[model samples]
Target: MDGRSLWRGAVAAGITLALGIGNASASFLVPQTALPGKNVPKYRDPLPTFAGSRVPATSGYTVSFEEFKQQVLPASGGFGPTTVWGYKINGNGPLWPGYTVEATKGSPATATYVNNLAGPGGTPPLLQKYLTVDQTIHWADPFKLRCMFTPMAAGCFDPYTGPVPAVAHLHGGEDKSDFDGGPEQWFTPNGMRGPAYRTYTSAGAPPAPANGAVYNYPNGQEATTLWFHDHALGTTRLNVYGGLAAFYFLRDDRDTGRADNPIRLPAGDQETEILIQDRQFDTAGQLLFPDGFPSGLNGAPPNPTVHPFWIPEFFGDVIVVNGKSWPYQNVEPRRYRLRLLNGSNARFYNLAFIDGVLRSAPIWQIGTDGGLLDAPVPIVYPGRLLLAPGERADVIVDFTPFAGKTVTLTNNAKAPFPSGMAADPQTTAQIMQFRVGTTVTGDTDGTCDPAASKKSGNKCVLRTTPMVKLATAKGTTAPGVTVATRRQLVLREIEGGGGPLEVLLNNTKWSGIMESTMGTTNTPVAGSTQLVDYWLTELPTLGSTEVWEIINTTGDAHPIHLHLVQFQIMNRQPYQANKYLSDWMAALTAAGKGPGDGPPNPYATVLTDTLSIGGQNQVIGGNLLVTPYLQGSPVPAAPNEQGWKDTVVMMPGEVTRIAVRFSPQGNPIGGSVGYSFDATDGPGYVWHCHILDHEDNEMMRPYIPVKP
Candidate 1:
């Protein structure tokens, strides 16, 4: 029989023979009373923030991962404490969504991260029960790397229950590649490390402990809202879901994060950082994740024979903010600067402030993933701010007019983004409530007000210093710089009998040999005998400006993010997706390669023998130009997206264009000027879809910067 028939037969026999051995007690839906909104207080303070160790002056900060318990659900609900794997700041708290690391712009900061997941005696912690590590995908397989050969191997198909591996990535931080925290830089509690793992200790910095790595950050970029999270190879989704994330604030003289600073923005008690996420829990308040078992709450896997317990996407019913389940915060009747972050694994949020049926106040977006925009974009009533996973927004919300009223922070974005199911009104739609204090406190609305009457001339005076604009709305380069090269990339999904089996960027896998469109073979690493190496493509010259045209043929939109530099959105134009896909397939067939010869070629081999189909070309070198399939005029970026961004949304059936300069945003637009640190060194950076599920799959790709 063929592979498909064999898979079907095996699934049927397993379900019939071992029906009771799987996750039978799992619940698909969480009860309302278990996590009612506004019951818990919002977690704001990152108690005793990481203040660099003074004993060893060069030892910037030290943090470690440890197991802890927190009351996720209320005591009246009869749910016990939930176990969490969290980061501790100087042994103070193993707090969920760990404490913020505050750094100055020009000063350099060094951090030593210790992998202490296996507590005291190197024993696995209680949080291990909530982890479901799918070995089928390419991950930090510390044991044998069996999956590198074939998924049918016994070691590859089973769950990984060994010492967990972890790596910390400072999302949106423009640092050296050694400290960028790429996927292959993982380390385990037992002193095991990945192939690309490297440790750096500046001049007099303290040495890293056993099973630890030290990273140094020059803090050379613009002041922005950046975050740090677990980014181990395939287990990023699980590690981050287990509460291994925290905020990292980069402050400068202009936006000093204090009220008396040059920008005159809200500070101290008037400013707050809010992290919004979605999660599910069992009846006992323990975290519940889908394992793709036939008899489990989540049904059978799409391709059971290939992957026993890997799902396409995950969406939880309950909304969580700042480590609390639908929590609330009481605020005074004045302007407050709220730095928002969407930390969910897959869920996208379109947030607004609603008082009953009407939007209560305007949300003025002053900054994006990179830094402050040229001017504030007013999101008035009936408008919502969209934030995908790993995206951040800095906004000022004036609550002066809504005194003595309760306003709810609501979400209306669909799951899986544009074309997915709508958010339920009673559950995922309502994020949190803001109970405005009845009394007017001692606060003043800043000079940058959102009201129309406060506008100077035609535009609202949001800032005194104007940010550098990179591109105009007409899709032309700004006066100073010119595009060095235009690269075209494609996003696609591979389907199985049940649903999506996996996704790929440019129809290539994470490792192995790939043939470019120019009929030349290029491997990620040169002369490497390892199972997996950096699958390098799209090599751009250091200090050069390039325009990347991302063509998305998939059904859903994806949030694309780059590691080293923040980019400018040029435009997005609709295209003929079907024609483009057909042409791509034809190009693959003409190259004398089998349909199932892409990355994870074994799975494709099985499909080709059984289904008689082919995959797209694993092309690089030359661009898969989109000009022939273009349909309409290009649409300019939204007002809020005009600023410097490290992540931007690419809609389906459209070609989204972005101009990226491989340097800090404050630098001049053109020439051979690079970063404060070496731009071409260590394991290079990566660009991938922000959807953690997609990123964990084959949707991520690495690129190196070559010094000119």
Candidate 2:
């Protein structure tokens, strides 16, 4: 049961990188000059914004998953019309960067999503499939479950060998389990379905349409920027990478009201919502992804026979803005609100506006993933807005100062994040260019309200005074409060005979065993003493508050995400990881469990559903793990990150303490009764890394909430 023994001697050298039956590798790469092609054809002129065909909660709408063409790059670049999949309303064409669905709080919205895509062409129709679906990993197989034996029996599904399966998950939504768009609820275009398929309907209602689902989105939580993306089991990375993601916003009286709203933020055209993604295109103008069975690792083929085309991370060289490569936008010299969402698979962005040199303009961050902050935090010149994949930042950028000059938005974040190699200058460095026109589009709001201006007459609508702070809680606990429960969990990466075979959440995979009864009668069968299969370990009591301490033992900084609820972050502290791990492993071995069995939870009050666990600079040697690279000091939450957040970054070698509540009635702020629907029900919910690749692998798990 020792963590070291679970993966010890798993890596067997000398495995050939030969192509298996389903192995693949990258065959092409875009020319280096193709990057920063800022002067490409000015096609796809006005970026499209979907405001929803019908007002949310009023009527149901339909979106068909179909393929279309877009002038992604200039024709001069020879990358002609590329066939990409997107959501279309009313049978419209070219809905790249799918339309935004708008809904109001407390109202329920309905939508029928249909899969109308055709399989790839071939002798008998090759059945368009996920080129990066790792068959060796645990996935959604239509047939039976395959179990691998180690200390315990761990199960996975066979590789999907048919037409592409698809489903949509409304990330950040608190919808019912039936409408949550779980990974197992996938359906193929030919009517073939997975095991967990369900019709999105109420009790006694008619079943959902065949090969489609009628999703009921209960907009019962705070108004925030949520997105819909494919959650099909093993191929999530390939599907989302194939352009099946869009935005959805839930509005409320607080976020947008007449007199009752305390915060009067920018609205309409003044506010621009953009989806930022990274991609690579083949010379034939087709979407390109790394072959599931690659022939090499970090340039040297390491046990290619293991996972031929599977790589730990996917980094694209081209910066895609709203589906256009290195696209440019013309802006009038004034204050404009930018809602930036990192929709990429793995790339992180340290965003900044570069004129000619390093920095020119300041970016004022007013909101985060969960919405408005207490006040605007000015990111001064040369400051970088660090955004991890799946993270969002709402900011106001003033173009008045650089009216005639062209400023380029740039990124400097390293690949694989913090400790990875620096990003390439020519490709990942430049994002998009902003051409500030000489025309002055003055603020027409006609309000001198201090809540919307930097000064008396500067005329900034959202740079208001007394910025609205929706939620803020930092420290061990909220002022004048007590925590009902506390628990500790660890994140680990398990190596295989080839390389990293899988990553585990609490040292468990997605299985049927209930972790809440691990040592009891519900535990795994005899002789299977290790914890490798998924078990329901965390069953938080409804209407209660608890502290969760996430301990990261791996080398990579993982973004930990929870479902159904958002949490606030407390403070992060450094620990003697080496000593603690040794003791923890000993305890687990004695109990006949893995290293994730038990550890005392630290009490801290911070809110977020997704947090980045900072990685420590540790060296892994034979039977000896050293942690001398641990930082001497603890890391604090960023100032802009003190507000309510669904996700936070946990640095390596750090213990991130978060205070989470099951019901809103126990909120630190003015409380509400609770959720509108039942918290404990159906297939339940899951929490995992927001990184698409990791989620597709073994880095995700499921948890169910139960009544107290």
Top model number, lDDT: 1
Model 1: what TM-score?
Answer: 0.87
Q: Encode model 2's per-residue lDDT on 16-131: one tens digit a residue.
A: 22222122234211111122223333333344443233124336667777766776766666668766777775455436677777778777778777776555541111213334
Worst 10 residues of 1 by lDDT: 606-615
What would the per-residue lDDT of candidate 1 be over residues 610-675, giving only the tens digit for each residue?
A: 111011122222324567788888888889888888988999999998888876777765544558
Spell out the clash pairs found in candidate 1: 595-614
lDDT of each: 0.72, 0.60
Please give the lDDT score at residue 332 for candidate 2. 74
Give TM-scores for every candidate, taking all chains together and pairing residue i with residue i: 0.87, 0.80
Root-mean-square deviation of every model: 6.8, 7.8
Q: Pick the candidate with the highest TM-score.
A: 1
What lDDT does candidate 1 reach at residue 206?
72
